[model samples]
Target: MANSPQPPLDALYQEALATFDTLLSQARGEGDPEPTAMTLASVEGARVSARIVLLKGVDARGFRFFTNYRSSKGEQLAAHPQAALCFHWKTLRNGVQVRVEGRVATLEAAESDEYFATRPRASQIGAWASAQSQTLADRAEFEARIDEFERRFECVPVPRPPHWGGFVLAPDRIEFWYGADFRLHERQCYERDADGAWSRRMLYP
Candidate 1:
């Protein structure tokens, strides 16, 4: 008798991608707004912070999102250069959870600019006006800043702000979890090694 052949790591990754696409599509069709929202966690030394961010892109490379470079999360990533992300869909009956852990890097300027161009004009101006994660004197002051930027870009295309751009999290570990009865859930994890090879394993639940 011969032993069973194991599936390649890349195959498992593709399967995970397919599953994500299917779930996302279903969520959208079921009228679940903000399906792309995810929780991003960052750390610097002993302190850690987590926030909700919208996912901008996903592919074999990793997950992508944009933020103000001067924000707290941005500062944390700069100091640590690694992070984790969690995506949960509770609207579904069984529910699904995805976890990703990886190193982070800033996206190229051109790529960021292209994505920025797709944002609504008001949002583009808001991106320019905001001093994210910083103390604001009052709502009036922030609105004034928005007004200023609005006047400055009148009848012109708003360019991506220098401090606003995207970050790509190149995942080293990715896990998918499915809710089960009696809390006996299922989990599948894929990890990349130093040699750039991937390995897949099942996690006890």
Candidate 2:
């Protein structure tokens, strides 16, 4: 097979970012929303568990997601304090994979309160009802709890769960990948040195 042309790391990064921005627009217009859902992977004693989660925010600081502070992923991230996030958009044949390693901290009470306020009433009630990652006797029992919470909080705004909050992943490494014709692919990686500066590099496909 012949080697296909590949975009330079910088160019590819810009292209992927542009495509991602367009995708974001489509989601907003359609009111479908970007899955922003990423596969979060955590390592524990050479074992790893991964699950999808909705991303709350992302920027130079890092990506943010909220969940129960005591959930399985939350506990693993707390103990290991490092994880990976992958965003793949099959509809566009594009994906962004980020590797983040940093300490995790629960969001401040004020921040959690503000975010919770923006959630739908049902979501707010569900948060209060669900134990998140804990076992329940049966589906009916869980539904009953949800109904109870709905009744209890009726006409009153649901408060943020004491155990619910968000975490920011300060990425030490960020990798962006793009698909191309044939099997040729483009990869660009950014590494943050001890001095807290980002350096970019290209990788073989």
Candidate 3:
């Protein structure tokens, strides 16, 4: 039930974030056996592109995700330096969108090394095999590359690719949306202030 009188913007934003986290947990226990991943968007002049990538880490400071540093998103981010992330939980009919304007750079080599060592052997090998965002001749060629990498690194620990790593998006603004009957959805937005604190606002439905 809606609060008979809507609460303050900060309260509303916090409440929506809590609800979204709860719904995400419920979604995880349902049909999808995958981890919570988000579609990351980056721009190039008039073009925008996005792809699903795993959520690697998060904190009050930022959200982090790892990928091949030579991938499409990487290239786009290198040029534009800002990106957005969207997480849609269809089962819950809810979504969270965050617009982050921050500098993008590779994670420390040690950070990447530690994470890579924790990944499954096959994924590590695949990381080396893939020339991410580059077109391959065919499926066979990709498989052949993977096979070659596997053979060359057999009985040895696969090292993290120099061209693969993580990016932390320091969000300047984050919006949480909840769908309601009659299309009067609930929306709460948080914007970072000059003092480095976040100010919350409620948008008209």
lDDT (tens digit, per residue) of candidate 2 on 1-205: 9999864444433443454456555545555445576788887778999998888876444678888878888788878887887776545454434344555556678877888899989899888888889999999999999999999998887888888888887766666676677758887776667865557789987
Of the two candidates 1 and 3, the one with more favorable lDDT, higher being better, is 1
Better of 1 and 2 by TM-score: 1
Cα shift from native, residue 65, model 3 (Å): 0.8
Candidate 1 lDDT over residue span 56-131, tens digit each: 9888778999999999998899889999999888776577788989999999999999999999999999999999
> TM per model?
0.92, 0.80, 0.82
Model 3 worst lDDT window (10 residues):
94-103
The candidate scoring highest on lDDT is 1
Of the candidates numbered 1 and 3, which has the greater TM-score value?
A: 1
The 0-to-1 C-alpha lDDT of every candidate, in the order given, reads 0.89, 0.73, 0.74
Using TM-score, give the best candidate's number: 1
RMSD of candidate 2 to the truth, in angstroms, is 9.6
After TM-score superposition, what is the CA distance of residue 186 in candidate 1 from its true location, in Å? Answer: 0.7
Q: Could you tell me the C-alpha RMSD of candidate 1 in Å?
A: 6.4
lDDT of 3 by residue, 14-126 (tens): 55446546756777766545547788888888899988888776654367788887888888888887888877665665433333344455567887788888999999999
